[model samples]
Target: MRALVLAILAALAVTGHSATVKAVHAEEREGFKVIVHPDNPARELERGFLRSAFLKKSTEWHGETVRPIDLATRFTVRDRFTTDVIGKTRAQLRSYWNQQIFSGKGVPPPEGESAAAVIAYVLAHRGAVGYLPASVDPGKARVVPVR
Candidate 1:
């Protein structure tokens, strides 16, 4: 039985499946739920969803709207944060969004540029949400795990 378990573990490692399954935990940010617009069909997201969508899969966000936050700023806000969490740096995200916008493939979310702008935009638009330093105002929106 021990040998069988070891073989299974070895196979999982060799297949690289274990690496893809890394778990993401829920974390608190400023205050809001970090949510999609209530009208959006997306009900819930996993914590790693952003990383998977933007970084790994490069999935175009096609809901009511979406926004990208800076990796460095997010990292400064919390130790648990990662570029992989939001999927890319500010420049990389901007490049991709611009491509989508120009191609008419999709409408990119407005750029917050800074954490404060993110707070303001999210507060004003129920359909928009993005991450900000925990130090910023939380009342602007909700904080939901990206996944």
Candidate 2:
């Protein structure tokens, strides 16, 4: 049994399956774009502030109510955003939201069914901020720097 397990691990390493999986996920994350309504005056956001906004800890931006948007949990871009930007995995975020709900402190951001929907919401709402795949043209929305 030990030899069988070692052989399987060797095969996986030789085939680079583990590394390939990580590479694919990282490639998918490369095209994510963070955006806000063009009317929003802020050009760039600090990463800490962006995380706070999405986490629903900071409710306002420049004195206006902030409307943070999210993609559905199943989306790859959402996974990347959660992991790379929010510094939390999907499961961690779910747990966080559950705690918030039970405590009556906050709720998760509204989820967009698709990237197009997210962009549309950001463009139409004055205080909206969301992310989309880089392939989408932002139109009047302004891309916010995550860093």
Off by over 4 Å in 1: 1-44, 47-82, 89-95
Give the per-residue lDDT of model 2 (tens digit) for 50-136. Answer: 898899888788767889999886677787788878998778999999999999988889999988888889988888899987777
Model 1, 38-117: lDDT tens digits are: 44455666666655443334444553334443323334332234433554545675677688779877654444566666
| Total clashing pairs for each candidate | 12, 0
- With a 3 Å backbone cut-off (N, CA, C), the pairs that clash in candidate 2 are none
Cα lDDT for residue 5, candidate 2: 100
Poorest lDDT segment (10 consecutive residues) of candidate 2: 23-32
Residue runs of model 2 more than 4 Å from their true location after superposition: 1-29
Candidate 1 residue-wise lDDT at 87: 45
Top candidate, metric lDDT: 2
